[model samples]
Target: MVTADRRQGRRRADPPPRRRRLPESPPPPPRSARTWTWTWGTLLVVAALAVLLLGRTDVLPLVAQRGAAVVLTTLYGVALAVRTGGRPVISGALCLVLGVAGVALAEPILLSGLVVLTGVVSAVLGVMLTLPAATFPGVVREVLVAVVVAAAGALAIEGYAAEVSRERLAYVVLALSLAGALLLVFRLGAGLHGLGRRGSVILAAGLGAVTVTLAYTEALRRWASPGLLGAFESFVAQVDATLGGVPQPLAILLGFPALAWGVSMRARRRQGWWVCAFGVAATGPLAVALASVGLVTAGFSLLYSLLAGLVVGYGVIRLDQFLTGPRGRRARQLEAASAHRPEPRRTAPVL
Candidate 1:
């Protein structure tokens, strides 16, 4: 090759660098399918078992009579523990120690603590999947599914073996719990938060706490007040007479959650005052009774229904916001007002 010579008095430029474009990456598949895979799989399995074994007396009475609940509980506990993958919370060492203590004690409190722990762990796992690859997100969902199934299965077994002086009340409580829980779970995937979740949760918690409180009070030999006692008698009469097919005190129970939800959504002043009024209305003269199926219990039933309505309404509004980006009401109103005004006309001078 000849040696290169430098240019003199002549401008020289370097050759332009070639630009190469990289191929664009394809968009990822939608995650709905993945989440559905686990949720559906779980629903299918549970549904199949329920359907197949539903009519069979063999499966019906077996668990209760045989203490199958304990087994189910153990299985559930283990499954959650596995799901957690022993992720540390607070402290790893502390978790291990407490977990071991809980195990060694086997007391009800300890066991209950463990159950709550597992739930917390499962939730954490779900939150964890919200980031990064979102890889195997369904795995965490499956684990939660497993937890609910196991807990319900075990509880059912326990309930069946449970001895209640009055089978009617026992069945009623169980039925209500089952119905409410079922409702909660059915809409679980719908992701109720703004109103749906908060409402439902409030309803569940408020009603649940009140019912438990009443039961405990009664257990402790507490007697109802004169008016309350009269209502109780009326409740007894209606139930015994078969006058109506209404759940007792359901409205009052329902009112708590609904009212709580309204307070959550609106300011403490505007909505809270009204909500408080209605709540007191439920608790006060039992005015909500008029809405109930039963003569005496309708007032409380109405109260609860009102609360549920509020919650559902609030939730719907919030969900709308989430789905369709938030917009100001004042801005929309102003735009509407402007639209009605005459359009501006341009004036041209003589050319």
Candidate 2:
């Protein structure tokens, strides 16, 4: 008859369902993030060194630095807006007026703090807006890392500047060392893309301009007659007061990196134009920071800006050549072939 098994109407209970283990996604390779971190970190370190050199020599005054910070933050916002295809020139102008008014009305310490806070917020917004929508999260993480690194670098520079306040030679040595480091970093970047002879020349010229400008400014400060220096100082002070202490020199200094980046991008045409544009735009903040810290003066800034403009213009011309040169020929051929392609005949539509 029906055995116990038959009575149960079932064989052994189905085995418990196996839990399928998913292969843990390999921790995302951090190459891209690390590269961005290093790039931004190096840039900040270089900026800190510049500030220290300028501040120790009284080139970057507190009032100038404050004004510069506000200006830079505004420029960064404008740059971000431009990159995102939004026209914020009017907004930027309005922000600048408001910043100047705020500076005029607020206490020095309070204004400085407010500017710093605004800079932080602007930096975050700029990064967020500049990144692609598809990869926003990864970009945000990288930007945060960069900000932390840059902040740490700035703090270290400030401490070092204080420590070496009395040591003129120490400042000189430190400036030279930082300059060398920057050169090495840029040389490496150039090397990565195999800069051609023309590229090398452009790079050398840019580096030389930076070096010469720094040396000239330092020399003018150190060796000029006390009468001359005093006259210059008075003039600078007047300018600062007239402009509400917004230093133009730092703005020019900020333009150098942009000019250099544009040259490099032109040297390697495969890179995006937007990247070069962004790099140039990003300098507005650095320029402000330098001004805030007393790393640049009005006269030198104007001179540097002129030189940087020349260099960037040259780079743009070179890039245009590529578009109109042999490469353009190949592109034209492709377009011609596509234009000549025949359309397939379709049967008349049935009524």
Candidate 3:
């Protein structure tokens, strides 16, 4: 009777799940290297089609016609949704549509639209996923701060470019470097919090060594490059002459701290550190190109990536320890075994 009642309740609750039309069955899963081979091949095809579609159209004005970018991103979101169970695909689709819309409007409405959309989208997605997207109350403030720093970087880059008479390019770069580093460091703090004392110390030392060495290597590259700093310097000089305000935007964009900051803060250990390092390394070239229009951008790109990588690597390892702990897993197993065995009671000594 109970089983019958329960079945009836389930029937009432779901209403039979109605026979839904399903997507077509895919081919059997490929093994080993075939997996990557297939995935990459599919991606290339999709990408080619998307490019052909977006490229031939003169949709929005040039800068925003970055629809090809949007398509790639949207498709990638769909792909991630497949791998990560759909969170990113959903979130990214929302971001793409909204971002494109914001970019489409005329001025007085355009930039404002972009800013509002950016904040709203971030807040909404963060809530949907339980990520700390800075609460709605403080999100605007944070966005504003990010904007200020990015704008400052852009203005400074512009100043450097156009040969504005100022002894302050060094100061501007210094400020941005400090701000970006601090952004990364604060991000690392999350990882550190996850790591307790012992794990934290060991991982810190390891990450520190790695970050320092990487930074040094990048510094060496800057010194060794054929054009030296001059090649870099002149690149900015040319940008200034051509487009005045581009550098600051590029700098702000560059200073956005590697995405690995999230993973680095999550793991506080081996896997986390690796994820953070890999993400930053993967993005290094792009970041460099995005930060400046010329040579200096390349040098700083390598420099910032190395620094961020090292910082996140060190921090993630530390946190991983705290979250998983050294003895927690083993202790649980031992306890489980003990629970199954009868306790050996001891007699008290005759008193």
Residue-by-residue lDDT tens digits, candidate 2, 275-308: 2222322232432333234324433443444455
User: What tens-digit string does per-residue lDDT give for candidate 3 at 1-351?
Assistant: 999999999888885556879998998444656467447735753563444334335443444333443443344334323432345546666756754664454343433333322222221111111111211222223223333223222322221112222223222333333333333333433445654575455445544643564466457555677766678668767865564322332122222222223232332222222222223222322222332343355445434543443344335433543465445757644533342222111111000
Cα lDDT tens digits, model 1, 138-252, are: 2223223322342243232322232223323322333333333333323322333433544455445654755675576465445657787778678767864573334334323
Each candidate: what lDDT? 0.35, 0.41, 0.36
Instruction: Give each model a TM-score.
Output: 0.31, 0.37, 0.32
Give the better candidate number (2 or 3) by lDDT: 2
Question: Candidate 2: where is the Cα deviation over 4 Å?
Answer: 1-193, 246-254, 257-351
C-alpha displacement of 137 in model 2, angstroms?
22
Least well predicted 10-residue stretch by lDDT in candidate 3: 342-351
Question: Which residue pairs clash within candidate 2?
Answer: 60-294, 65-291, 65-292, 249-301
Rank order by TM-score, top first?
2, 3, 1
Ten-residue stretch with the least lDDT total in model 2: 342-351
Of candidate 1, the 10-residue stretch with the lowest lDDT total is 342-351
Q: Of the pair 1 and 2, which is ahead by TM-score?
A: 2
